[model samples]
Target: MSKEGRNANGIETLAAETLQRVMEHPATQNDIATVETQLGRYPRGMVAVGARCVGDGTPLVVITGPVLPGGIPFPTTMYLTSPEAVKAVSHLEADGLMRQYNEMLADDTNLRAQYERAHAAYLAFRHGLAERLNESEEHIEGISAGGMPVRVKCLHALVAQSLVMGPGVNPIGDMALERMRNEFDPTVCRCVRAQSDGQETR
Candidate 1:
């Protein structure tokens, strides 16, 4: 779709377009270096670096290609690569927050509707990505990350999507981030040096 046409589809479409343009661009040497240093290895099928640190503008999350090796369709579009963020999310997950979020989704109708919309938007974006990349969308069609549109599963995936797509895109992600404010605050710079080596995360 043309950029102008996508703009007319509303915020979700605009976010998809922004992500599409990022996906089309090749990963720069600097991007590769920082991500590799942060991850301790080379990242595969990395389409674009999405959200960055508010303090330093360093890349935190990334949008990955729909398909990877062995003809596998990757369901998680946005990946949280930041160790600090990952740690924070892990803590939340360990706290059994997914069960609580799932209960919330079951109890509230409006929240469920919003989550369903998020699922649709996520699928639309991924399908567009598949078309742009010349990959088959059959396996991942209608599939979105974090058990969206039904239940809460992975806060990390949801949070990554929320961070990349901006606020109001993923309700569960927004809620999870809100709950874990003390553990992780994107506004502050948490990019510390890796304990194994002296290299900075970003």
Candidate 2:
């Protein structure tokens, strides 16, 4: 089907357009180096910087290809790379927030519908990325990260999606992010590297 037809069919054309822009620009060597430090390993199949920190403008989320270089299937598209963000989200998970989110999803009909939409958008975005890369999407078809459309499994994945797609894309992610504002604020540069660099410059 044509791109327009696919958009009309409820595929997130806006996300596809954003993916195109990201592909056109690509990530810099500095971005890769920083992400390596943040993740403690080289990120595989990284496409571009999906989102940046509001304060220091460092890479916050990465957009990865649907398949790795070795032809391994990777369904996760938006990956959170910042250590502070990861730690904050991990704290939330440790606090049993996922159980609360699952309960909310069970009771709130509107929230469930919103989460379902988020899942569909995630799938569309992953398929769009795969198509752009000319990679096969068969292995990860219908699979979205964050246990979407049914339950809240991972706040890290959900928050990554929210950061990349912006607010309102993932309701549970938005909620998680809101709750973690006291712990981690994206608008503030709480990155360990950023703090270390500040100390050295002083």
Candidate 3:
């Protein structure tokens, strides 16, 4: 298959996986509440829980709608909500991992191609979500979060996409996750609050 064909197939697979996740784990009020606690505010435009903590089932990442309630365009689809995960990625960003990834992308053509494909897949996935929500994609067309295709701006955004879409979809995200393996393990529950208790106290 040609590169375009492969890209299209990748996009379709990702879109299908996202929709299936939505079907299987539809967002609940409790999930919103938990995410709000994790984020220290109510999550806006969240459509579904993209990924949950393997340890305690807390929402680790959320899938936001393409447009907000008032028709505001939101380009970020996958948002990291786990406090532990956020802190780990934030530490990596503080250590200048993004600059290293950017430098790597500048030197490696193959990596650049993969990053471009990831960007395309992100756009496709967002568009699919927009269609599902009956929202316009005009405002955020060709726009994806995390400084994809050219730069590594936000490790948190990239890592969120990686956790939601799984590894190999975003190489930079995979790298970030790998680098932070010691600090953040999704398999182990690192959530500060015990979600099972249903207590709002943090």
Q: Quick one: best TM-score, which candidate? A: 3
lDDT of predicted model 2: 0.84
Candidate 1 residue runs with Cα over 4 Å from true position: 1-8, 20-26, 194-202
lDDT of 2 by residue, 18-100 (tens): 67766776888888878877887899999899888888878989989888999999988899988789999999999999999
Ranking by TM-score: 3, 2, 1
Q: Write the per-residue lDDT of candidate 3 for residues 129-172, one digit (tens) a residue.
A: 87777889898888899998788888888999888888888999
Each model's lDDT comes to: 0.78, 0.84, 0.85
Which pairs, if any, clash in model 3? none
Clashes of each: 0, 0, 0
Off by over 4 Å in 3: 194-202
Ordered from best to worst lDDT, the candidate numbers read 3, 2, 1
- TM-score of model 3 (CA atoms): 0.92
